[model samples]
Target chain A: MSTEVEIKSFIVRNFAPDVPPDQLEPDLNLLDSGVVDSLGLLRLIAWVGERFDIAVEEADISPDNFRSVDAIAAFVADARRNSEVAR
Target chain B: MRWNDDQQALHDAITELGDLLSENRAERDAAAVFPRANWDRVRATGLLGLPFPDRWGGLDQDLLTTMYVLEGLGHSCRDSGLSFSVSTHMVSVGVPLLRFGSAALKERYLPKVCDGSAIGAHAITEPDNGSDIMGMRTTAVRDGDEYVLTGGKTFVSNAPVADLFVVYARTGKAGSPNAITAFLVERDTPGLSVGTPIGKMGLRTSPFSEVSLDGCRVPATNRIGGEGAGFLVLDHVMKWEILCSFIINVGEMQHRLERCVEYATTREQFGQPIGSYQSVSNRIVDMKIAVETSRKWLYDTADKLQRGENVTTDIAIAKLTASEGNVSSALAAVQIFGGYGYTTEYGIEQGLRDAVGGTIYSGTSDVQRQRIARMLGI
Candidate 1:
C-alpha cells in the first residue's frame, strides 16, 4: 500500500473506526474535526514510529505535521529521508 | 548505559547529602510539615538542576543521568515527602518551561528554576477534572497583550511553597484537543491564591494545596508553548514526571528490599533465622522483583524518551508497573518486618504510606491501565 493509504487505514481503524478508510479525507483537519484527541495524537505518533520505523522527535510533534493523513505521510517520508541521509 | 566518572561523582555528591536531608524526617512526617531546611540544603547541592542546561545554573545532565542521581536521592533519603517535593519541583515547572517556553521566558525564568531559588509546581487537575484533562473548565481568554485566566486547581504538589506554576487553562472549545493552553503564572500574580496545605495519606511532608486563579492576567509572553499546545507540553512533562519521580520510588524500593533482607536474615524465630523459612523469604524475594521491575521500567522508558521516540504506551505501562510495584513492595516490606515494620519508629510504615501516593498521583493506576488500553486500540 502507498504511504497515504496505509496512514488513512490506520487512522480510520484506530481513530474513526466507523468511517470507511476511503471515506476519510486526506486533508480533513483531524484536530479541528475532533477526529483525534490528545491521547489519540500520542497513539497516532507511536503507531507512526513503529509502522514506519521512524523516530518522531519532540520538535516534529507540531500540529502541522499531524493535521491529516497527507501531512502524516509527508512527515513519515521526510523523517525517513532525514534518517537515511544521517546514516 | 555505563556512567562516566563525572556522573558517578555527581550521584555520589547528592547521596552524601542524604544524612542531612533525612534528619528529623520522622518528626516532620508526623507533623505533615515541609522540611524547609532540607529543601534549602537540596537547593545548595544543585541537584534540583539536573537535566537542565548549564547556562541556567544546571549540571547539564542527561535524562538517564538525572534519573540515576535521583535514584541515589531516593535510596539514601528516608524522607519520602521531601524527595517527592524535589521531583515535583523539577518536572512540574522546569521540565516544561525548558522544553516549551520561549527564549525570552527561558532567559527570564530558567535561571531561577535551575538555581532552585524559585520552586516550581503545576496546576492541571481540578476538583472536577482529574483524569480527564480535556474536560477541564478553567478558561483563559486573550485580552490585548495578556491572557486572563479564571479557574481552580486541586491536589497541586508543592503549591504551598511554589514560586511558579505552569497553569493549563482552556483557550478554545471545551473537550477539544487544541482547547487548552499553558501559562507561566507566578505565585505573586494578582488574584492567584494558594490554599493552606491539605493533609494527605502519604508523602505528607511534600505539602500540596488548592490554587485558585481568579481573573489573573498573565502576559502573552508567559505562555509556555503555542496556543492550544498545552496537551503536548503536558505530555512531555508527564513523561519526565513519571520517569524522574518513579525512579526515586525505585531507589526507595531497593532500600526497603535491603532492609527486609537484613531483617529476615538477622531476626530469629524459633531459634532460626526468619529468612530460612520459605514464607518469610518469599516476600523478600517479591520485594526484590518489584524493585528490579520498577527500575527496569523507569530506566527503559527514560532511555526511549531520550531517543525521541513515541512512548505513549511505554510510559503508561512504566508508570503503572512502578507505581503499583512500589505500593506492593512497601506492603511486602511492612509484612516482612512484622510488628517492627508496623511501628512508626522503624519508618517502614511511612514507606508504605509514601508508596500509596505514587499510585494516586501522576495518573492513578486505573488511569494508566486505561491509557494502555487506548493505545492498544481498545
Candidate 2:
C-alpha cells in the first residue's frame, strides 16, 4: 500500500471509524475537524512512527506535520530521507 | 545504560545528601510543612537541572542519567514528599521551557530554573476538570501585547512555594486539540493568588494549592510554545513527569523492599524469622518483583523515549506498572512490619500513604489504562 493509503486506513480505523477510507479527504484538517483529539494525536504519531519506521523526535511534533494525511506522509518521507542521509 | 565515573559521582553525591535531606522528615511530614532547609540543600546539589543544558547553569545530564540519579534520591531520601516536590519542580516548568520556549525566554528564565533560585510548577488540572485537559475552562484571550488569563487551577504541585508556573488555558474553542495554550506566568503576576496549602493523604510535605488567575495579563513573549501548542507541550512534560517522578517511586520501592526483607529475616515471630514462612517470604518476593519490574519498565521506556520512538503506550504501561507496584509494595511492607508498620514511628504507614498518590497523580491508573486501550485501538 502507498504511504497515504496506509495512513488514511490507520486514521479511519482508529479515529474515524464512521468515515470510509476512500472518502476521508487527504487534506481534511484532522486537528480542527475533531477527527483526532489530543489522545488521538498521540495514537496517530505512534502509529506513524511504527508503520513508517520513522523516529518522530520532539521537534517534529508540530500540529502542522499531523494536520492532514498528505502532511503526515510528507513528514514520514522527509524523516526517512533525513535518517538515511545521516546514516 | 551504565553510568560512567562522572554520572556515578553525581548519583553518589545526591545519595550522600539523602541523610541530610531526610533529617526531621517524620516531624515535617506530621506537620505537613515544606522543608525549607532541605530545599536549600537540594538546590546546592544542582539536581534540579539534571536534564537541562549546562549553558543555563544545569548539570547537563541526559534523561537516563537524570532518572538514574533521581532513583538514587528515592532510595536514599526517607521523605517521599520532598522527593516528589524536587521532581515536580524540575519537570513542571523547566522541562517545557527548555523544550518549547524561545531563545530569549530561555536566556531569561532558564538560569533561574537551573539554579533552583526560582522554583517551578505547572497548572493543568482545574477544580472541575481533573484529568480532562480538553475540558479546561481557563481562557487566555489575546489583548494587544498581553494575553488576559482568567481561570483557576487545582492540585498544582509546588504552587505554594513556586516562583513560576506554566499555566495552560484555552485560546480557542473548547474540546479542540488546538484550543489550549501554555504561558509562563510569574507567581507575582497581578490577579494571580495561590491558596493556602491544601491538606492531602500523602506527599504532605510537598505543598500544593489552588492557583487563581483572574484577568492576569502576561506578555505575548511569555507564551511557552506556539499558540494552541499547550497540548503538545503538556504531552512532552507528562512523559518526563511519569518517568522522572515514578523513577523516584522505583527508588522508594527498592528501599521499602530492602526494609521488608531485613525485617522479615531479623524480626522474630512464632519462634523463627517470619521470612522462613512461605506466606511472609512470598510477600517479600513479590515486593522484590515489583521493584525490579517497576525499574525495568521505567528505564526501558526512558531508553525508548531517548531514541525518539513513539512511547504513547509504553509510557502508559510504565506509569501503570510503577504506580500500581509502588502502592502494593508499600502495603506489603506495612504488613510485613506488622504492628511496627501500622504505627507512625517507623514511617511505614507514611510510605503507604505516599504510595497511594502515585496511582492518582500525573495520570490516574484508570486514565493510563484508557490511554493504553486507545493505543490498542480499543
Candidate 3:
C-alpha cells in the first residue's frame, strides 16, 4: 500500500481501532462522524508528526487538513515530501 | 517533540489494561474486596515492580510510565479506594525505601515489595497533627540496641494488610524542627497493633485503620536515614502523592464527562434528546471544560516532573484544580443520571463520595489554597 494508507492506518488505530481502513475517505468529517474529536485530533497529529518525522505548523492544522484519515495521511505525506525538498 | 515507539507501545498497554480494569470496577467496588486477584494480574504484568531496578525483578520504567499506568488504572477501574491503596504503598512506602534505604534494607525488602509478596504503609498523621507535622506527639526513645516507640497514627491506608510501615516518631524535644525520625517497622512487632478498620465516606474499598504503637521496639538497623530526617522524607513524598492523586481525579473526570456526553445525546426528553436543551447541554459543556483544563494542567505538571523542574506552585494549583474539577464533574454525572445516580446501582453517587475524599485527603483543599496564596506572596 501507499505511505498515506499506512499512515492512515496508524492514526485510526490510535484513536478508533474499530474503524475499517476501507471506510476512510479523504473528505469524510472525522469529528462530526464521531470517529475522533478535538483532543483526539491533536493526539493523532502528534502521532503522525512523530512517525513520519515531519513538523506540522499550527496555522496549517485545521479540520480541512485533518477531517479524515485519508486527508491526514495525505497531509503528512506532503509535509514529509516538502521537508525533503527544503533539505 | 513526539512519543517514540516504546512510549507508544507502553501507552497502548496501559489503555488496554485500563479497559480491562474498568470492566471489573463495579464488582470490585461493590464487594469492597482487597483486589488480590487484580493485584496478581498487575504483578504478572510487572506493574507492581515498575519503578524498582530491573536487577531486582522490576520494570525499572521511567516516572512517565508510572504516571500513565496509574492514570489509566484510575480512568478505567473507577475504584478510587483500590487505586489509593496501590499508590500509597508505591509512593509513600516503596519510593522512600528505594530512594533512601541502605543496601542491606534494599536487599531485604525491595524484592518482596517488587513481587507483591508484601505491601507497605507510611505513618505521618497523628490524632492531634493531621496537617501539622511538627505537632505530632509520637515518640521513639533510644535504648541500648533498640528504640521503644510509643505513638498512635490514624487514617493510614493499607494498614490492615500491610507487612511493613515506614513510621514517623519524635526522637527529640517537642516542637524541635528536627525532632522527628523515621523507622521501618515490621507488622508483627511486639507492641505494634492494628486497630479496627475505619468506615469511611468514600474510598471504602481500601483498608484504613488506626495504628497504635504501645512500647513498640524496633532495632536501630530499621531506622531510615538519620536523626530528624523524617520530616524531609515526608516533604519529598507529599509532592508525588498530591500529583498522583490529581492524575487519578483527571482520569475519573474524563470517564464521567464522557458518560455525561453519551447519556445526554441518547436519553430523550419531550420527544428529543435531553442534550438539545440548553440546561442539560450546558452542564455537559461545563464538565468538558473542567476535564479539558484539568487534563492540560495534569500533563503540564507531569512533564515538569519528568524534567525535574521546580513545580511547587504548579503542583499546588493542579491539585486544587483537579480536586474541584473532580467534585464538580462527579456531581454533574449524578444530575445527568438523575435517580439512578443517587443509588449504588448506577455507581455515580459512589464516584461523588470517592471524589469528596480527594478534597480532604492529600492535604485538604484548604491547605492547597494556602499554598497557592503563599506562593503568590500574599
Best by TM-score, which number?
Answer: 2
lDDT of 3 at B261: 85
Report the CA-based lDDT of candidate 3 relative to the real structure: 0.74
Worst 10 residues of 2 chain B by lDDT: B172-181
Arranged by TM-score with the best first, the candidates are 2, 1, 3
lDDT by residue (B1-378, candidate 2, tens digit) is 578999899999999998898888889999999998898999999998899999999999989999999999999999999999999999998999888899999999989998889999999999999989899999999999999999999999999999999999999878888788999999999989999999999999999999999999999999998998888889899999999999999999998888888888898888999999899999989999998998999999999889888788989999999999999999998889889999989999999999999999998999999999888888
Candidate 2 stretches greater than 4 Å from native: A58-60, A77-87
Q: Which residue segments of model 3 deviate by more than 4 Å?
A: A1-87, B18-31
Interface RMSD, every prediction, one decimal place: 1.9, 1.5, 23.2
Q: Rank the candidates by lDDT, best first.
A: 2, 1, 3
Estimate, for each residue in B96-146, the C-alpha lDDT of model 1 and write its tens digit.
Answer: 888888998889998999888999999999999999999999999999999
lDDT winner between candidates 1 and 2:
2
Which ranking of candidates, highest DockQ first? 2, 1, 3
Candidate 3 - CAPRI tier?
A: incorrect
Candidate 1: tens digits of C-alpha lDDT, residues A3-65: 999999988888888999989989898987899987788788778888888765633346557
> Cα deviation of B65 in candidate 3 (Å)?
2.1
- Considering just the first chain, candidate 3 attains a TM-score of 0.73
